[model samples]
Target chain A: DQQVKQNSPSLSVQEGRISILNCDYTNSMFDYFLWYKKYPAEGPTFLISISSIKDKNEDGRFTVFLNKSAKHLSLHIVPSQPGDSAVYFCAANPGNTPLVFGKGTRLSVIA
Target chain B: NAGVTQTPKFRILKIGQSMTLQCAQDMNHNYMYWYRQDPGMGLKLIYYSVGAGITDKGEVPNGYNVSRSTTEDFPLRLELAAPSQTSVYFCASSYRRETGNEQFFGPGTRLTVL
Candidate 1:
């Protein structure tokens, strides 16, 4: 069963616009959530993460908001750039257990 | 420093063949993990190691073996290749920090079985 899910397979946005990606989880025990971006033929790179204790975290242009009650999380990129185009995967770790990942959302930024 | 390194970027194996995928990390992270990714699917954990000589199976560990002889190396072995095993494999490592721990991944190894 897929504990973590990213329902949107693809998202497109204009450059310099805000891009929002959403994720949902079924396992309530997950305490840590992370987002990774991957390019073609390359391994995924870490982007941003949020702890269960905090509802929001921001790093540079990327921000992650978590809603514990709804079991949903989202990543927002301000003034999205063309370089931001890639597949983003949402992952969660439940109390020291191995991380579970979502299928991923492909983001395309049109210049 | 090369954070995580995986050799044999691409490989093709016949059914019943066996091979070892090499993974090495220069970051000196104590936690290492192996995951496989299929098309339109997220990564699935195959195995993991907390430290030297400490190994455990993850979500999808069947037909696989692993050993941690040193902190820098963690290799995954496929006893017998199957068509279902064809996928892109990634090796990752993370520090022991309680918070803000981010996993660094290698370029990944793509394996195909016929």
Candidate 2:
């Protein structure tokens, strides 16, 4: 079973606009959530993370929001740039166990 | 530092063949992990090690074996190659500390089995 799910397979946004990617998880035990950005033929690089204790975390142009009641989380990038185009993966970690990842969403920022 | 490094970036294997994927890290991390990524599916953990001479199976460990002989080296072994095993494999390492620790991944190795 897929504990983490990214419903959208792909997303497109214009430069300088806000790009939002959504993810949901079925497991309630997950306390830490992370987002990773991956380019072609490269490994996934950590971007932003949010702990269950907080509802939101921000880093520069990226912001992650978590809703524990809904078991959903979203990543928002404001003023999206062309360089932001890549596959974004959402992962969840329950306690000390390994991360469970979503299928990934391909984000395309148009110039 | 070179961080994490994986050998044989690409490989092709036939059924019943056996080979080992080598991984090494220069950051002197005590925790190491192996994961595989298929087409649209995300990465799945295969095995992990806490320290030298210690190993444990992860999400998907069947048909695979792993060993950690030193703080820098963790090798993954494929006993019998199968078509279902064709995928991209990644090796990662992290410090023993739990807080503020993030895994560093290798470039990955693409394996094709026929």
Candidate 3:
């Protein structure tokens, strides 16, 4: 069974608008969640993360909100830009273990 | 620092052939990992090591092997390549600290088996 899931295979948004990507997990043991962004032919890069203890974390135009009770998390990108187009992967782990990654959501920001 | 790097960015192997994917890190990290991403699928852990001389299996360890003899290098070997083994391989390194175990990744190696 998949511990982490990203139901949407892709999403598109207009530049300067808000883009929301969602993720869900079935593993309750997961205490830490993270988002990674990847471009074609490139490795994934760390974006943002949230601990189960907190409900939200933000960095500049990117914000990650976690609803532990719902086993759901969403990544919000405000003023989305063309540069933000890429594949976004949601990952989670139970503290120090290896992370379990979701299938990924391809985000396209149109200019 | 170069962070994490993988060699032979792309490769094609015939059935029954064997090859090794090289991974190296310049950050002197204690934790190193190898993951494979199949088409339309998330990355799956194949193997990992916490330190030199200590290696462990991950979610998908079949048809693959790994060794970490030094802090800077971790190599994964595939024996008798098969079509199912075709995928993009990624190498990552990280320090086990309070920084959320954020990992640094290499560009990745794409392998195709015929």
The model with the greater lDDT, 1 or 2, is 1
lDDT of 2 by residue, B1-114 (tens): 998999899999999999999999999898899999999878899999988999999999999999888999999999989999999999999873433346788989999999
Error of 1 at A24 (Å): 1.0
When 2 and 3 are scored with TM-score, the better candidate is 3
Q: TM-score for all predictions?
A: 0.96, 0.94, 0.97
Q: Across the candidates, what are chain A's individual TM-scores?
A: 0.98, 0.98, 0.98
lDDT of 3 by residue, A49-103 (tens): 9988899999999999999889999999998999999999999876767888999
For each candidate, what's the DockQ? 0.72, 0.55, 0.77
| CA deviation > 4 Å runs, candidate 3 | none
Candidate 2 deviant stretches above 4 angstroms: B96-101
Number of the top-ranking candidate, with TM-score as the measure:
3
User: With candidate 3 superimposed using the best TM-score fit, by how many Å does residue A72's alpha carbon deviate from the native?
Assistant: 0.9
Fnat (0 to 1) per candidate: 0.66, 0.36, 0.68
User: Model 3: how large is the Cα RMSD against the reference?
Assistant: 0.9
Model 2 docking category: medium
